[model samples]
Target: MALTLALESSSSSRGEGGGDGHGSCRPRESMFEKVVTPSDVGKLNRLVVPKHLAEKHLPLPGAAARAGGTVLCFHDARGGEAAWRFRYSYWSSSQSYVMTKGWSRYVRDKRLAAGDTVSFYRDGARLFIDCRRIRRAGVVPAVPPRQPQQAFFFHNQQQAAVQPQQHLVVAPRVVVVDDEVEEARRRRCLRLFGVNLELELRAEPLLLDLQL
Candidate 1:
């Protein structure tokens, strides 16, 4: 009985130690953090990167505007694991703001064009920006001017002396009728008949001679 009690006590101690070791071996938390959605910002506010922003040096809004900082980290939309750094400076030309030094490189890498939008949000001390590309209007292909189409009119052989064969070139004209006016006219014409009948019904009008 003494030997059996000793064996049971040893087994219990081993089981408790194994459980504690397993708990301690758990994986650490992820480095990447969750970003706040644009909707959460009142009025869905975001800064739109102008055409000039990519070309000339410009001052971007900083922490006051929720975009200013000395260093910003850009996370890949595919996955937040990949990140790029952008160094910026805060200064006051007219007012205090943050200007990104290496923003041009990021713009070139993303192939961002004028009218594209970008928004920035903060995760603790880190600043992150999201980009949205705008589709530019394509250049319209030039259409060559159409040459006039000559329509030949031939006269009867017997009447060739009085009337000669002639060529006529007709210029195309587009006529636009006001829908409101046309509808009003149609209503008036229907009311004149004293019965509601389809406009296809055509009747002759009577004429009287008034000669004294």
Candidate 2:
């Protein structure tokens, strides 16, 4: 079956199968992506995977695995193993498949929020998760500009404040060739003598020599 795994929106591509191993192996292509919702990044502490994608791509937990949920190892975008293994389980009450256990830590470290897209890919037995952040128009930075560090000393009801470090701004020095500077000076003199600057600038050496 053809898989729509490209990172591009609504694009599809076929990828070669990889060996079934873990550690340091990157997936050839993405399998599918899900747009994050508020609940996914909220206090729910779990991520709800689409039933179709979960059934097709994720391995179903057996009775033993279901006791606590199967541990699913996932690699980050850089192909490195994620810090924690996610627990995959079917939630009968919600009638959905969700990633639990380590989901909240993943969301926190990745700083994922609603509207961000998370793509899933598999290479052999290794699975990967990549995040694509949605850009917001006219969004201001949360942290203010850093101010100079302050040092305060208090002794015998007296306060002494340390001065802030001085920042020096060095202007760029222009390099001028002596010959070019002299040529420009001569040109200015010629212009003062009613000589056209353009004519002098464009004048051929042979023509100027002849005129001279």
Candidate 3:
């Protein structure tokens, strides 16, 4: 599968993209179209994919609390111990715990390897990832270079939390988002990159009792 793009979401439709070859899009219906104009619709929220992670990063729904914000981040078993770097703008409070991108310093921090579920905590402005309990999936996420054709390490976990107390989405992936981020943020994510990807609007997990 040539290392297909990875996607994470909780709502909306469309799973991760490996390139369907056939472009499948179900447009807006009549009345809904009347109320929402193309321009206004054009200004709707879109997922922000990093330039390096565009085709590779999938916009999926966030996972549930019981399951922890964890998903089987698909990867090509091709590269061994190689650093796969991608870019991202957002990360759930927990996923943002580890260092997104930096030369070093996170030596004490636990890396987000495959199979390992990460727990996050927000002490102040920054979100801290739990470095102790992550069970590595044995595959390492490779980092990219700025010299072009190289891999990037910055991948974003969209900002949307889900309420475990309510009905779950049941979808493999989901997103946790802030109310302030509307379509403007979405367009910027696309404009900042260059390709259009699927987006699902899901709830973020409540930030209460998160002492961990």
Candidate 3, after superposition: displacement of residue 92 in Å? 17
**C-alpha lDDT (0 to 100) for residue 170 of candidate 2:** 19
Candidate 2 structure quality by residue, lDDT tens digits, 186-207: 3211110111122223243312
lDDT of 1 by residue, 158-204 (tens): 23211112221223321111112223234211110011111321243
Q: Check candidate 1 and list the clashing pairs.
A: 62-68, 63-68
The number of clashing residue pairs in each candidate reads 2, 0, 49
Segments of candidate 3 deviating more than 4 angstroms: 1-100, 103-112, 132-212
Task: Candidate 1: list runs displaced more than 4 Å.
Answer: 1-69, 123-126, 136-212
lDDT values, one for every candidate: 0.30, 0.51, 0.24
C-alpha RMSD (angstroms) for model 2: 22.9
lDDT score at residue 160, model 2, on the 0-100 scale: 24
- C-alpha lDDT of residue 108 in model 1: 40
Q: Could you tell me the TM-score of candidate 2?
A: 0.52
Model 2 per-residue lDDT at 205: 33
Cα RMSD to the true fold for all candidates: 29.3, 22.9, 22.1
Q: Point out the worst 10-residue segment of candidate 2 by lDDT.
A: 188-197
